[model samples]
Target: MSFTVAIVGRPNVGKSTLFNRLVGKKLALVDDTPGVTRDRRPGDAKLVDLRFRIIDTAGLEEAGPDTLEGRMRAQTEAAIDEADLSLFVVDAKTGLTPLDKTLGEMLRRRGKPVVLVANKSEARGSDSGFYDAYTLGLGEPVPISAEHGQGMIDLRDAIVEALGPEKAFDEDEDDEAETDVDVSAGSFAGEGDSDEDFEPAYDDTKPLRVAIVGRPNAGKSTLINRFLGEDRLLTGPEAGITRDSISVEWDWRGRTIKMFDTAGMRRKARVQEKLEKLSVADALRAIRFAETVVIVFDATIPFEKQDLQIVDLVLREGRAAVLAFNKWDLVEDPQAFLTDLREKTERLLPQARGIRAVPISGQTGYGLDKLMQNIIDTDMVWNKRISTARLNRWLESSQIQHPPPAVSGRRIRLKYMTQVKARPPAFMISCTRSDALPESYVRYLINGLRADFQMPGVPIRIHFKSAENPYEHKRKKR
Candidate 1:
């Protein structure tokens, strides 16, 4: 029984700060720049005993439909529609402006429950703004400092009251029950169980961690907002507005997914600013931790050198990847563009030869289903493991077809092979004079293993081990 609360306000009013506080994590990019948030980002938040979904939205602005601010406004409106309540934040230091008044009237017209918040109340001069909030006609405003954790008790009481006392009690009871069950399960496990037989209880229903990464302004945030059906992240004409990796949990077609909206990655040489370097490091961290990465590209200028580099990094990191061509609606000839793109992908990214490339319009919500499906499929491949017997059979067949080249007039004798691990599929091969194996022969075996095992677009690792000779012990004694 999760309810949603949308935090709406003009730019730089501490909406993201409050969101991070409620969620107990810094999951949104908080900056002093006005209108930094463009998408509506959602997170599971708890205020004291009250639990609900919280959304951080773009700032409200007065602009026409054709303008970027107008589009941001539309996204905020959509969030308000989806939310059960709206936390209308105002700058207590600056008092109520015309924009706040306008937003108050807009929320009033919607006739939904709104909790008017006077943020930055910790400052000495905030009393005036706090008093001014009473004039909004949406009931008394709760004055609190979102940055310093002030006035949270009042805010929590307001939320509990708005949601009704009965619902609050029910949530408490559910939490207690869940805690009791967890304790009971822990006590049930015995210490005598063998490591192989003692399977740790884990929920297979946990959310899949997916990271969206690409060059700056590649529509990564837009794609996530579309999936959520709200303006959940800050998007605008400005590039690099998102400075942190923001993660939001979502359910898609009954599958739980934890989506990471990361800052756009730029080449190291061009990243001169300290902030930009930190942002790139954060994005790299997200990519390394992610189970699957969707590398986004602007369709108008798809597959720049940087984009290819990003894809190569994903492969090198051994993470599953899917290529996404965004803003497909603007493409004039879709079929031709896709054909050319596919050819280029195969030629440039041979490591991930059969990687799925989806053409999508994040704004229009086209091809999203295919993109998600591809992610699931790629994850499956990434976790694939082959049996040892099957691997040895494949190895034998491969050696018969193209035998390892002779080294210094002596034939290199290949022995058996076995799969050492999964999750990118690592293998080990024992052979006589393993150092004599040519790089070309190693590649031949790798290609053969990939083809035989149907492992496309996932990195495979092979390690060569020298088989110990039985006569070596006698020679050592001599």
Candidate 2:
């Protein structure tokens, strides 16, 4: 039976570093900055033969219950309560401080099994600090260098001993309840599957990966928390409260979804801080990997340049997008405001034509159902595919109606076209003088595909190749 472990300690104590080590991935952002991790992130971690769930939480700090830091501490406490064990990490290079001692006392009162981890033991002058960790009375400190990958075997032994054999080696406990959608090429491959027309079956069992992104303090976290029916993420009036891409698995109307709450992205010029840059990079990564993206906007001030830029970025990445005008409760004329938003979307984001814009209020939970429905619908359209026969018929009709412009007194002949892939559907077209095809013609074809196929608001890609000549080989070598 696998168990859950929570990594907790003061800021800059290498809690996140040890999390990355145990998870065997840099899933949690690690930096010299303290309190970089504000939300508790869970990962399926394996150490030696021991398989378990590990949670990386924000740095423990003494703050009032109303402040952001207090909310972060509450999250950490929740994680500790939920975990079967807690890894109380301490800085072996700096020794235990008042804050660490205070946190140790707090953990001791909870009576949860904790293994003291003295990180940075590989560094010089760490011996004194490592020895000092014994004073906390949390049992022997596992001295290891989380950064240099030293003493992992000892840490594994400690975990095994703490959990005991029954829980540590129980393989029949079943995996985590959450399901992850495989993003590998083979999992979503469509091209060359068959010569006949075939629509690839989409597995509904796997969780749908949806990313919620927007500018700072645009109510992204609030919207997610509302969906979860709990304060799963830290939210406040303060801007930039979230600095990491946090993923949560949830079930919506019997459909599984793995929702990602990303850090707020700012303009490139305003992203001068190193930590913010890291956060932005994390957000962009979420966008690239996600199957669908929701661009949240504050309804009071919608369609800002940065908002449009974010939408463009999502389109450029070829991910399915839905526009969410948040804080709609504050809008006086909701219908008129929504109409205006849709008009702006059409004018500003013509690339994602007919995009669904739902007015929502993250605070009051208004219009969340419609927003989610739009997201589901948009994802379906993004994964749509058209048969070769149907595409050819449409192409033939399109050509007859509006023929390709002649180049250099010669006509551009459109030959054949077929969908090579989906997931932001892409098509390959065979034509005469492919290099001479105008951009307008390509846009025309793309628009035709969208309109004729009813694939609205999803990015479509089209490529052209020269039609092979059967008479060239018969002409003989020169």
Q: In TM-score terms, which candidate is top?
A: 2
Single out the weakest 10-residue window by summed lDDT for candidate 1: 176-185
Candidate 2: residue 301 Cα off by (Å): 0.8
> Clashing residue pairs, candidate 2?
1-170
C-alpha lDDT of candidate 2 relative to the true structure: 0.89
Q: Stretches of candidate 2 above 4 Å error?
A: 176-185, 200-203, 468-478
lDDT of 1: 0.82
Model 1, TM vs. native:
0.76
lDDT against the true structure, each candidate: 0.82, 0.89
TM-scores, all models, native as reference: 0.76, 0.96
- Give lDDT tens digits, candidate 1, residues 1-478: 3577999999999999999898887667676767667767777787887777788888899999767788778878999999988999999899999989999999999988889999999998989999999999988899899999999999988877776777544543354211101112222223223232233332335457899999999899889989998656767777886776777768978887878898898887899876677678878888877878999999999879999999999989988899999999999999999999999999988877788899998999999999998898887777665656677777788878888888899988778776655556677899989988898888888788778777788888899999788899999999
